[model samples]
Target chain A: MEFTVQDKGHYTEVAANGRLNMVAAPKLRKVVDEVVNGGGKRIVVNLADTSFMDSSGLGALIGCLKLARQSGGDLRIAAVQPQVTMVLELTSMNRVLTPHATAGEAFGND
Target chain B: MTDILARRTLEEPAAEQAIEDLHVLLEQLWLDAAFVPAPDQMAFTTAVIEAASNVVQHGVPTEGATLLLGVELTVAVERLRAVISEIGAAPLDPVPDLAGPSDLPGPDDDALLEDYDESGRGLSMIRALVTTVTVEREGDTNVWVLSRDSGQG
Candidate 1:
């Protein structure tokens, strides 16, 4: 899996490209941690290319969310694929890390 | 006997790499059996990955034995199935609870989300995706048989 963090002025967009499974879960946390620690508070995880995400991946996202919140910011997700969406809903995490329609829109209203 | 339409089998040391490799095998099996719908393919793939990940993450190897991840994926006209085994592993001390929902906070229950169970979500997900799932101990292996009905109207 590949991860790219781009500063979009309003919020940092962290794009995850590939399966976000057990193997790639920790990598995601590391990327998001870097964003949060590097003065990028408002973050949007772009999952447009992430085809799959198991529980491990979900946990990583939740962990990132907490880290962001504790720092007086928030983490959001956008462009979730079908499989990833199913996981979010099935695990009932959709409410916590809501999926925005697009990365550009994640922080648009804030 | 049921004639298998398409099948893929993989066996390796139950490690992180094995999960990645088995995902590739799943894609290959779907390519060979294109008759399965996209939704079925996605759901089945997720379930299989979760089960296999469970073995790698939680399965304990017996004394002086190496845990191996063994997977057998089979696709037929009306079904998609996989037998994921934890080879040379110790028996599950407290077998997984596949009957009811495990301890996952509701989507809107943000307060309880802080206490979410790490391992429970995967098993719950497998239960939600497959038509039927069963796990048992045979000799030294813990086998997970997962089947999903495909192309059902």
Candidate 2:
């Protein structure tokens, strides 16, 4: 997976593209660590361009959420496609983590 | 490749050959379930590959210990069901209480990500795809039941 991190002042937007599978999960975890270590709490993961997410990918996201929350911040998702949305829904992630229609909405700007 | 199929098993080293054999099996099933969409097909294949690879790597230390993979493809008007079973290691828990992705952390977080070099996201992908997944352990065998909706295909 290719991830581009944008520093959005109060929150950081991590945009992920390509497949987030076992192979790419480590990079994701590293990125999350960078965000947390950098003291950026409020996070928005934009998955609009992400084509695939496996259990490993989901686990990484959850881990990041936990870390971010423990640090007094939260992780939100936006622009989830149908396939990835199906995974999130089947796993009941939509209930625990809020998914917005756009990055701006997740950031509470829209 | 005949249309009417019966069950079979293959045992090989953890080399590329084994993955190739698995691909062949998946290809046959994918062709049989033509109505299933591309994403579903890929998900199912990935799950099978992950499970099978796990058996080769963790379940059996030596190549002598055979990894049993059974495939059954049933087609109806509304759905296609593919059940893959393997005689291998018993997982900590096959059907984990996953309320949401946020409820649990990745194996890597808890330091459970074994073999960091290769992939350990089989169960994760399995949970991602498929309408329903049922995992059962009987004696020494682990069975994974996967079903995909043909209508959605």
Candidate 3:
């Protein structure tokens, strides 16, 4: 998977493309770490193009969420695909990640 | 013996690259077995990958042996099955707890997330996605068989 980071004024948007499996899980952590370390307070991971995700990927997301929280920032996910959504709902992590319809909508109210 | 409408198989060194290749093979399998419901395909694929990933990440190799990941995916009219094998690997010292967790962690279980074992989640996800999942040692290989009833009518 490839990630692109964009500063969306209020928050930074990191768009992830392709399958987010074990192969891409570590890369995700590296990218999220960069965002948090660079003073990114509110971050949104756009998963509009992420077609698949497994437990490894889900774990990475959870790890990233914790990292952001630890740094006094927040990490949110947006535009989750069906397969990704299934994993999240199955693991019940959806309650924590709470997929947003769009990157712009995440952290919009907060 | 059931008639297989579609089949895909792969045997390679158990590594991260194998997982990437397995993903491609699954996509091709769906093309040949498009009759399977989308939901079935999605769920079965996730279960297979989870099983395969488990092999790559956790399968221990014997002395001077290179572990190999072997996958056999088949689609029948009413079922989808996968045989994920860990070749050239040592026996599971402490066999995995295939029964999975009694109760999955919830959002309120934030403490669980703090020190979560991603590997454990992979096993639990597999159990939830497939109708039946089992692991057995066959000589030098540990075989994971996952079956999901499909053909949603």
Candidate 4:
């Protein structure tokens, strides 16, 4: 998966385009780590183009969430695809990494 | 014997690239077996990928042997099945627990994430997605068979 990290003013948007499987898991960690180290908190991973994700990808998301929280900020996911949504729901991780309809709405209520 | 509506197979070095290749093969299978329901396609595809990924990530090579990922996917009139082989690998030190859904972690996401094992999650997802899943040592390979009942109109 190719990740594009953009500074969206209030939050940094990391858009992943491609399958988010084991092949892309470590890359995600690197991108999120850079964002957190770059002083960009309030992160949002835009999964609009991510067609598939397995356990490895989910684990990466969880780790990134923890990193963001540890840095005194937060990370959220938005625009989840059908398959990705299914994995999240099956593993019950959706409760922690709730999906938003759009990136803008991820932190809208916060 | 049931008539196979579609079939795809692959053998590659057990690595990250094999997972991506398997995804492509799955897409081709779905196209050929377009009659299969979307839910079944989704669930079976997820199970196959999870099983293949486990081999790529966890299968240990035997002495002087290189590990390879082998996948055989088939779609019949009323079922979807995959035989994933961890070729040239040693037997699992501790055989995996192929228990049921009760093995899944509870709804506490915080605690779940704190001590989550992706390998374990992958196994659980495979079990939950397919109607049946089993692993056994076949010669130098650890064979995983996953079957999901489908095509019931």
| lDDT values, one for every candidate | 0.90, 0.63, 0.91, 0.91
TM-score of chain B of 3: 0.93
- Over B9-74, each residue of candidate 1 has an lDDT whose tens digit, in order, gives 999999999999998999899889988888899899999999999999998999999999999999
| lDDT at B58, model 4 | 84
- Among these predictions, the greatest DockQ belongs to 4
Between candidates 2 and 3, name the one with more favorable lDDT.
3
lDDT string, candidate 1, A1-110, tens digits: 99999999989999999999999999999998888889888999999999889999999999999999999999999999999988888888887888999999998878
On residues A38-98, what C-alpha lDDT tens digit does candidate 4 reach at each position?
Answer: 9988999999999999999999999999999999999999999999999998888888899
Report how far residue A49 has shifted in candidate 1, in Å.
1.0
| Model 1: how far residue B119 lies from native, Å | 0.8
- Which one wins by TM-score: 2 or 3? 3
Candidate 3 chain B least-lDDT 10 residues: B100-109
Candidate 4: segments with Cα more than 4 A from true spot:
B151-153
RMSD of candidates 1 onward, in order: 1.5, 7.7, 1.4, 1.2
Clash pairs, model 2 backbone: A55-B124, A55-B125
Per-residue lDDT of model 4, residues B21-72, tens digit only:
9999999989899999988998998989889888888889999999999999
Model no. 2, DockQ: 0.09
